[model samples]
Structures are given as C-alpha cells and as structure tokens.
Target: MGKTYCHPAMKQLKDQQTRYAPKERRLEQVERAEQLLGEIDRTKRYPYDYLCFRITGFRPDNWSALMIEGDEARRDLRQFVEDLSATVRQPVEQATEPVLTVDEVSKKYNVSTRTVTRWRRQGLVARRFVIDGRAKVGFLESSLQRFVAEHRGQVERGSRFRQLTDAEKDEIIRRARRMSQFRSGEVGLIEIARRIARKMARSTETVRLTLKAYDREHPDRAIFGPSTTPLDDDAKAQIYLRHRMGVSAENLAVEYGRTRSSVYRIINEVRAQRILETKLEFIGNESFDDSKAKSVIMAPLPAPADGKAPRRPKAPKGLPPYLASLYEVPLLDREQEAHLFRQMNYLKSEAVKLREKLDPAKAKTAALDKIDELQEQALAVKNQIIRANLRLVVSIAKRHVGPMNNFFELVSDGNMSLIRAVEKFDYARGNKFSTYASWAIMKNYARTIPEENYRRDRFVTGHEEMFEAAADNRIDEHEYESALKRMQEAIRGMLDRLDDREKMIITSRFGLGGASERTLEQLGRELGITKERVRQIESRGVDKLRRIAGEQKLDLPML
Candidate 1:
C-alpha cells in the first residue's frame, strides 16, 4: 500500500471515460465519489463505462464492457476520490462526516503508523487528501468506527508487534525462495508469502511488502524468478484474452505467479495497445460535451406503443406498384428526425473524444467493440431515418421524370441525394428534413436531366438523313446486308412475343441496342430483385425464345 501502483481506471478516467465535471458544484461530485466506497462491492468486477455511468450519470463516448476489480480497481477509485476532493473550488462544508488524517487517527487511537497501515490491510478504509496544502492519507470517521467495532482486539493490541528488522526480512526472503524452489507444483508468491507470514507470526501483507521491496531494490537478484519482469507483448495479449473470456485477475495472478495488481496493469497496457493500434473515424460535434447531451440527444423517438406502425397517406389510385410500395413506409415526425440525427452525431462525437486520447499508453474488445457497437447503432438509426423519408424520393422523381428519363432511374438518383442529405443535415437548425432532401434531389436532377436528354438526342437521326448516307464498297455487299437483316428480323419477331420482364432481361443480358452487357447482380440491384431471380428470368426468357424459333422454323444463330 505504501509503494506506488498504477490503477487501471485512473488513467482511463482521464483518457477514455467521459467525465461529468460541472464547474458550478464539484462538492456534490466529491460527495458522490465518497459514497461509492460503500456502494461498490469489492468482490465483483465491473465495466469501466458502467462505472463511469454510475458515478457521472452519463455514458462514456466509447462505451466499453471491460471489467476491472481487486486492488487495481480499489486503489484507482480511492486515488480518484482523493483527486476529486482535492479539486473542490469551495470548502467542503457538507462532508457527510469528519475525516481524520493518518497521524490523527494514530494519535487518537494510540496506535502506531505501522498498525494504521496494518489496519488498511485488515479492511479499514482510508483515502488520500490534500489538507492545508499537504497531501495526506485520511480515514472516514464512520469507516474507522466500523473497523474498530469489528476488530477491537486487533485494534487494541496494535503496534505491540515490532517492525521487521533487516535479519528477519532476509530470513523471510530466504524462506520464500526455499519454498518456491523446493516445491515445484505451480506455487505463487502469495502462497510463499502466506507460509512465511504464518511461521514468522507477521501479517501476510507485511511479509509480502518486504519481499517486494527487496526484489525492487535489487532487480537482478529477484526472489520470485521473472515475476517482476515486464511481460512480453504475447503474454500480455494472452492475459487480456482470458480476462475478456471472464477469467478473474485473481486466477491470473495465481497462474502467472504475479500480484493481482501486476496482472491488471498488463491487461490495461494491452488494452491501451489495441486502442492505439485501431483506426477509428467519426463526425465530431460540439453537442457531445454538453452536460445534458446524452439525455437530450438520445431522447426517445415517438413510436406507436402497440408495435404496429400506422401507415402514412396512401398513394394516388392506379399509381405504379413501385411508387405504391414507397407510400407504405411510415414517415418520421419532426421529433424523431431530430432524435435520430442527434443520436448519430452524438455517438460519433463520443468516439472521436476517445480517439483524442491516443498519446497515453497507460491503459479492448470492450473499447474497440464498444466503438463498433456505437457505429452499428448509428447506422441502424440512419437507415431507419432514410426509410421513413423514402416516399419523398418518389414524389420528387415523379416531377423529374421525362420522356427520355425513366421514372425508376430518376427515383434511383433521388435516393443517393436523399442519403447524402441525411448525412449532412444538422437537426439542431429546427427545419424540416424533407425540405432539405427535396432541394438536394432537385439540384441533382438539374445536373442530370439535361445530360440524359442530350445523350439520347445525340444518337437519334431522321429517315432522310439515313437514306442519304453512302454504302460501303465491299464484295457481295447486298447479300451480306440481306442475311444480316434476316437475322435481325428473326430476333425482333421473337422479342415481340415475350412479356415486358422477359424482354428487358434478354436485352440487358445480351447488350442489345448497343448497350453494355450487365451482370445478374448489377441488374438485380437496379430491378430490386435477387441475383438468383434475375438469372431465373433470363433463363426463362432464353428458353421462350428457343421454343418460338423452333415452332416458327426460323434459323437463328446460337439458338
């Protein structure tokens, strides 16, 4: 407890977590941080995001499910409370109860400082505080009384035990080495420390700290093999994977012959490695850092409670089947559009906030996975918005359709404009999304409709102009032209006999009318059908053409 240990959550609080630091009243935050010591169960591990949410009432931007516990979590939170209390702009007049410094507690209870340290090892809660410009350890009056009431005998007999001398420490180290060396059945430092503590009649923490101090002072001459050495990248990865799979740090500490704190440090270091290695992109918004951002941006969208969505206005009678389907999609009210846009932007803003802290390698499925989850949620919300407004695309397309431009093709182009509008629209401006989308679609049509008409007219010619063109000077030209005409006549005659769908599939597949041949997948996307369905239609059309040729006794090449 005396030595420095890196707590995992402390760095993440400054790096990854969203802090709820209100400038007006930080004393309440201090009180909340103090209350947490009793509320949090020390035995269980918890996600850092969930912890942040509980403390700050706001979910972090990169909401993760990384679980942390044991001495690592406890020490981090204690230091967090310490730092939190230190930052109170005004005096903390409303502390639930008075707190005593380490010296004060020792003097008040007639116990040695070692006994106070031992009391911490025996579950007497203590926190760090900066009082009168000096940082000191303080114990809550309530926590002290609780510890004393429970361990009266231990508290009363405190400091009667003397501190370990150099000889006793050396003897303890010798015993630890002997126990570890002679017994080769996966013995850890804890077992060695406990056995030595029992034989020497000292607290387990005292024995443990003595061995650590010795190893740290003389790194090359360590008692616990390579346990104190920094783990390789691969070993850190393995430990993190096991943690993701629900292995406790305690178990990892035992298996790796390291303290739980060391194991947690490695796990977070690997976490920091992955977060640094990943590439994340997001649209940043100033709204995310606001105090009430999560609640306001993530406000629930209006929906029918019965689970069945009520339809919007019906399409005009005798409308095309495709246009009719568009009308079936429910429209989003103003509230929902705002909610979705805000949520999408907010989610990305939080991710960018997390990405901003990449400089520190002090702390991932949970982190990276949480980022991925946020993206997926944002996408789902975007799609929901796009679908609700699709009828707008059809309405605009109906106006843009010309004799040369296909109605469905105009609708298809309008869809791309609508998607871009959804991405770029700022819902905070308090305007109708459809109005924006309509302008976007018309702007696209303004650029596209003229190009389409010009291309179509460029290839068209009058009959008199065609007749005036000169013929090629080749041998057997008339016979060759006659044969080519017959082949074309046969194909045209058969094409007239098939249905509209069959004709379209055959023409698109074979590149008729000098158009480039289209694959089944491309055609399926354009037709709103599966590739398999397109293939089936093409096959059926070809079979019909072959049967008609056979019945008519027509000679068609490659039939």
Candidate 2:
C-alpha cells in the first residue's frame, strides 16, 4: 500500500495492446476459415459443392471453379475461398421492442380482429408503420396497458343502476294514474314518466324502471285503474258503430275511458271480425234452409197483421248487410222528399254565403269551426238521400244478377257506384235522382263484367242482351240535349270573333256550318290561295276557338 503506481513501460504496453486488438480479431476469423477448409479436403466423401455450402453458407453456381478440382490448384482455391469469405455477409440480430400484431392481440384478449380495430378507433392503440407499401397493425406492449386500464371498470346494463325502493315504485304508479286522468284516459308509461320525471327530480329511465318493478311485484294491483282494463266485446262493437257514425278516435277514447291506442285496436278488431264473418256467411257452398233463408232475406213489404195494412221491415243496424241478405231501408214519400230537397237548397245557400265570407288559407279557428259544422250537416243530408236511393241500386243489381251470378257482389259494386253518383249528382238539373243514378249504375255494371272471360264467351243472352239494346237505343235526355244545343251556340259565338274569311274557312273545313267537311285544297281553291296558306288560316282560327272554349269551361278533349 506504500506505492502502487504504474511504470512508464506499462503505459507504453497498454497503448500497443489497444492498437493491435482489431487486427488480432481479423486474423482469428481467417484462421477459423482455413481450419474448416482443411477439414473439408480431408472429408472427400462429401461433395465439394456441399462442402462450400456448409463452410461459407452459400453454394456457388460453379462449384467446380470454386473448389479448384485438381490438387495442383490448391493455391488458387485458397485465394478464391478468401475472396468469397470477404464478399459474404453475416446476418445481424437487431434489438427491437416486442410488438403484438392484430391477430396476436385478438387471440391474447380472446376477442376478434374487429375488436382490435374498435380499440384502434377508440384511441386505445397507435397505428403501426407500413412495411413494403402494405399497412399493418401492431400494438406495442405499453399500448395494451392503456387499453386494459381504460376498459377495467365494471359496467351496468339496461336502464337500472340499483334496486327500486317500494316508496319510489308507489310514487311512479301514482304519477302515472294522475297523468292518465289528466290526458282523459290516454296515457302510456313513457308519456307518464316524461311528465313526472321533472317533478320527482329523477330520470325517465328511473321512473320507468320503478313502474316496471311495481307491475312485476304486484300483479293483483289495479295498476292504471279503468284506463288499463281491456274493453269487452259489446263495448268494442258499440265503439265501432259510433266511429262509423263519425265520432273521432280521441273523442271516443275520452268518452269510453280508454287510451287512443286501445280505441283504434278495438275498432280494427271489430272491423276484421265483421269482414271474416261476412265472408264465411256469403262464400259458403251449403244449400240454404228455406224457412231460415226466408227470415234472413228482407222483404219490401211485410204481410198485413190482423187485417192492418202491410209495413216495411224494421230498419237494420250497423252498415247495410250484403244485398243477398234481408235489409229493408225506409223509403221517402214525395212529401218527405220535397221537404228534404227544400232544406238542402236553404243549406246550400247558407253554406255558399259562409264560404264566400271565409278564406280557408287565412281563416280564424272560429271560422274553421263554422265551416266544419256546415260541412257535417251537408254530409248528413247527402247520406239521407243516398240511403233513400239504396233500393234503386238493388233493383238494378237484381236485373244484372244472371250474368254476375254472385248477387251480393253485384249489389256491393252497385252500392259503390251509387255513392259515386250521390257525390256527382246535381240537384239543379231538375231530373229525378233515380234517373241520374240509373245511368251511373248501368255504366259501372257494364265495366263490372270480367273483360277476359267476356271476350272468351262471345255469346250474349238474357238480360245482358236487353241491357246492351237499351244502352244502344236510349235517347239522350232533354237536359243533356239542351246543353249540347247551348254548347253549339257558344261555338258559333266564338267563331264570329274571327274575320269573315277565317270564319267561313273553319266552318266549312269542320262541317261546323251543317255541310260536308271540305278539304284544305278544296278550301284553298274556293279562297283562291295555296292549301298551305289555307291550312295556316285554319290553324289560327282553331287556336282562337280553343282559347274561347277553355274560357267557357267546355270539356273538349280534342282541343
């Protein structure tokens, strides 16, 4: 411990050692290669190509040249081996952080590639760099830690965080009842919760969950009381009848202490049931029992009871039954019909005055209410008239029954046509309503026959022949004939607006002057001009006439 110091010679030795270390390492590698070559030469059993591959980790294309086959060329073979050793490169091991690919991460998490993609979307993983222009996903070990940390919390499903208390459930039920009453028996759980959530300082989900739990716990409870009770069949049928009589669903629900949804459900159910029953009754192949069938069929007049005059069968309920069934609608006498017509005229006048005074686009609520009221009254009057003339549809339907075979089907079609006739009928025409309706009914029935089947069976017989003949031979009514005459006069007046030459050319060309139609060339000759010039004048005059006709509200399809 007295003096542990390096000498001057030791310092020089350390410098020398450092300078020769790299050269020494290179020499050792060369020595190793020489020993391997010596070993290969001794083992002649192994092919030279195989020896070069094992020693240098590469098989040269020309093993003969690389090996120097003759022993005399051992020096050249050594030189070749040296050059090969210098040119060959050893593979290097790179120090890199371990990465998990999308597939590997999916397997590790027991999930799918889609889940890994979702993690990337949620910023749980960083995008991996591309290799060879191809995109790849590789999550670093540290990124997985972030993913695990972010998704580690326990989660609640559905709308519940904890169990609902008894008091909370009772409160929800009470609020729901109040809401149903306020809405006039038109309440649902969601609607009730939306209204009560604010007052209770809770979410709609909480209120809904409480109510749901209450329902599960107390099955015997009244729940929403009368509003929640399902309607009976009698009540359903009455709802349907009233709805047909023009009551709104909202009003119906309020009157019946039920929800609007329940009202609509009841009405649809009854209508479907009635339709099914009707189809079952009418579409049967079973033969009718005479006594039962007679009772089912309605008569226009029942036989006198105890020598009293006969009376029509009592009016049926609901919609008029199928025409094959008994349904006697009360008819109107001349006096009653006259009174209704007078009332219609007065109502029409009042309605016209109201309509003239009101602007629908800018009307106030009161004006709209008045308009609706008047319309309803007018509709009621029209319905009375339609019901009175329903027999007319049946009478005509009976005449067409031979071809139609299904009497009920004919009656149904006739009834629809009769409704149309009612909508289109003009009381100011001074013609009988029956006369107008007959034409409408006959036109509909003519179209009712299946054209495909009618064409196949070319023969016409029975009432069909009579119908065709009547349609062909019937004369136009005086009202329509007079209207035609007025239309002709209007056309004559419109023509007079043109110059004398134009009027003469148009009248002669179209036979409008009660003469044979003259050709453009003939007119051109008479007028001493080219047919092209005559054609131009004719077009001009026709255009003028069309403008005039449109102004007069004439229904001219050709124009």
Candidate 3:
C-alpha cells in the first residue's frame, strides 16, 4: 500500500464515508474514482500515472485508491505539515525574541519612536532584518526585559509620568493663592512660594501658578495693602531708643518684624522733625529776647511795623550831637560806602601784620624786666578792654552751649581771641576791636563743639578725658622712675659687695655700665680667665646676690 496520508479531521470524515458505503456502491465508487482521476488530471496538470503513484502505495491493485484520493489528499496533507511547523517555530521564536513592534515598544516604554530608533542606533536594541523590502525591527526578549527592569525606577519617578500626591497638590494650590494675593501686596508671595516648593520638591514657578489658581477660586481671603503697618508711638519710641543706643537696622528689623527700609524711614523722619522744630523755636526765642533788650536800652521809642528802621531813643547824657548824628547816619551814595569799605580793608590788612609781629611768649619775659614801668599802663589798658566788652565771654560761650557745657573753658578760649584782637586793633578800619574779637571768639567756640558727643558728661568730654589720661600717665611715669632709681641703687649696693673679678664679670655680662650685653667669652678674655671659669664665677655671684637679696628682704631683678 502507498503511504497513508490524512488530516485528522479529514481522516475521520473519510472513515465515516467508507463505513456507510455498501458493495452495491463499490461499482459506483469505482466509476466516481475514474471520473475524479480525469478531473484531477485536467485541473492539476499532472499525468495520471504520476498522480496515482503519489496518492497510492505503488501497487497495481491500489490503482483505484490512488485515483480516488489523488491531489486533494496530497494538498491537504502538505498544508497540515506546514501549519504544524509554523506553530512549533512561532513560540520558539517568541521565547527568544520580542514580539512587540517598534510602535508598540515605544508606547509600552512611554518613549517616542525617535527614541526607539536612537536606542537601536546606539546598539541598545538588536539590529533588524528587511522582509519584502520593508524594514522589520525586533529586540531580543532578554534585552527588552532587562531594559524595562533597568528603567522601571526612572519611569515610575519621571516628571512627565509621575502623579503628585495630595499634599503636594494642596501645597501648589496654596502657593498659587499666595501669588495672586502678592500682586496686591496682600501676602508674602516669595515666602509662600518658597515654602510650598520646598515641601513638594518642585520649582517655585510651579508652586506660584498653583497658588494663583487657588487665589482665583477663593478671592475673598486674599491679603492686601503694605506688608507692614506704620509703627505706633510706643514702637516709634522703642525704635528711637534702639537707634540712640546704636542698635543696627538689620538687627532691629528682625526684632520688630519690619524691613530695614521701614525702620530707617521712621528713625530719620523723627530725628529731622525734632531738629527742625528745635532750631525754629530757638531762633524765635532769640529774636524775641533781642527785641526786648533793644526796647530796654532805647525806651519810649516808636515801634516800626515794616522793620525798616531802628526806633532810636532820646540821646544819652555823654554822647555829643555830632557822634549821635554819625551813629544814625547811613551812606547816602553807594560810591561813598564803597570808598569807606576800601579804606577799612586796607587798615585791617596793616593791623593783621602788626599783630603777627608781637609774640606773647617774648612779651611776657620783656614785661617782667619793665614791670614797674608798664604795670600800671597794662592794668589800665586791660580794664578798658574788659569794660568795653562786658559780656564778650558770655556771648562767646552761649554760641557753644547748644550741646556742651564747661563755661570756664569757653571763657579761657575767648580770652585768647580778645588778646589777639587788642594786638591787631585798627580804629581806622571802621570795625571796632570788640567787633573783631566777637568774630574770632565765635569762630573758635563753634569750632570746638564736636559733631558728636562721644562722652556723656561735659566734665568728661573726649578732649578733657584725653588730657586727664595724659596727666595720669605722667604721674605713673614718675612713680615708675622712682621705683627704677631705687632698684638701680639697690643693684649698685649689691655690686659693691662682690669681689673685683666677679664684679667686672657681672657688670659686663649684664651690660650695667652701658646698653650692651657681653658674651661669656668676651667677659672671660677681658678678665684673663677661661669662659667656663667665667660662667662658674658668674653663677656663684648670682647665687650670692640671691642670698644677699633674701637677707635684705629684696626681690631679685628679672632678666
């Protein structure tokens, strides 16, 4: 028999058909087989013998089976074997290789097609083959598995992929609200954004947008106005105290919950207003006092409403009419005033030169030599100047009394200026000695007033303290000198008791006579002894000195 060939389902159908066939149908089957053979030859284009041989086991008796089965059975059997091979190959190939298409892999990995191409280019995936002129790409199963496992952590935490937790979303919402409020100065937007971003580990801008959305949804609770409010009087006072006490603005801002700019504005405004009010009040009071004094000096005078002229009193007993007329006279022409000013300036220059020629130090010595001859004249001149400028010192001291005291010091300073004015006096200058002295005294007084009061008390002003410290240093120096002299005397007395060799060695070694220390060798050579012997003798002499110092209850001098 020819090799039996059958599809499992087809074979079962054929068996059922054969079992139903009877002997009377055998002749009909034979006739059908011959007809089928004829049809197979026409359709399949095969010779009858070849087709019959393929279908049946090459036997003359099996010719009818061959003709009946023919190409239909052969075609079915070939299809079944092909399908079985495909089924076996498919799972085997799938086990070793990836079944996913490039597009599918990209979607699975959450990456772009370009990214997948890049991975293939970088050898991250296996090279592909071309089928039917179309590029067919694939990856090894192990490679895909490893790639997925390696990047799983990155995928889970990727910015584009990861979802924010409830807390993070809430924080972002809060920040957005703050940003919207911040535009109106209602909230500290920067701080709020910063806090939210830190908690969420996100960018500040992200938090800012979130806050803005939150603020839109809940607009009523938005903060507004300035970040800070104006300080109360007590707060102002506290700030002033801190400023006066020299607290830094940075530190004050931290303590007061304000910015440096706010604190500075308050301090400066308060100080400036206080100073302006004080200066204005002082000027007003001074003007009032001046008017009162003028009224007392020239009583029963009519007050001038326009401030054009001084209301003069009736002439005093000692004044001549011409002198009074001169006092009241104003230059009628500008030329006359100019001429007088020129002459005054010339006289003033000459007077300054003459004043420079007189030396107070030399004058004091010269005055002693001719004391009896000039004493009376000097006393008379001094009395006249004092009588002329009665309140000169008081006026000079008043100008310096703003924030300082020490009236007597101001007076002594004025006395120096008065002496200089007297020496340089030029009556022809059209300016009196009192007027010149007034300028000099005022200049010196104003110059001495410090810009800042470093010392709290007038008695302990910086300059005074400096002088006191210098005087104290001088006293300390005197005490030190006294002690040093006593120590030298004691050392000298101790030296007298030493032997001549020891004395010379000790004196040279310690540099007692002059200001140079001698080496042991130099001292030893000078004394005609070995250096070692000199050292020994020097050591013994030191011990003896210590003993003598102990017996005399004296402290040995330090080296």
Model 2 / residue 352 / CA error / Å: 5.2
Candidate 3's displacement at residue 313, Å, is 47
Candidate 2 local accuracy as lDDT?
A: 0.54
Superior candidate under TM-score, 1 versus 3:
1
Predicted model with the maximum TM-score: 1
- Cα lDDT tens digits for candidate 2, 13-113: 22222223353443333334344444434223444555444434455454433332333122222333233223222111110345577777777766546
Cand. 1 Cα-lDDT: 0.70
Give per-residue CA lDDT, model 3, range 40-100, as digits (tens): 4214433334533333323233233333243444343333222222222223242333456
Tell me the lDDT of candidate 3.
Answer: 0.48
Which tens-of-lDDT digit does each residue in 1-559 have in candidate 1?
Answer: 3222244444456322223355334455445655675566768877777667666677775547566774455555555655555544333233457978788888887766777876775467665555676656677798788779878866665645667888998899899888877986478877778789778877676788888888888888877655546677888899988876556676798787778887877776777666656654444567777877678777667675455677677788855576787787777777777777888878776765665663334443345545545655677678878888888898788787654566778889999999899888888779989999999999999999998888877976422221122334674788668766776777778888999988988887777766666767567878888778999998898889889989988755456
RMSD of each: 13.2, 40.4, 49.3
Quote model 3's TM-score.
Answer: 0.19
> What are the Cα lDDT values of the candidates?
0.70, 0.54, 0.48
lDDT, candidate 3, at 1: 9
Candidate 1: segments with Cα more than 4 A from true spot? 1-91, 101-103, 106-139, 152-161, 216-222, 227-235, 241-251, 259-262, 277-279, 284-559
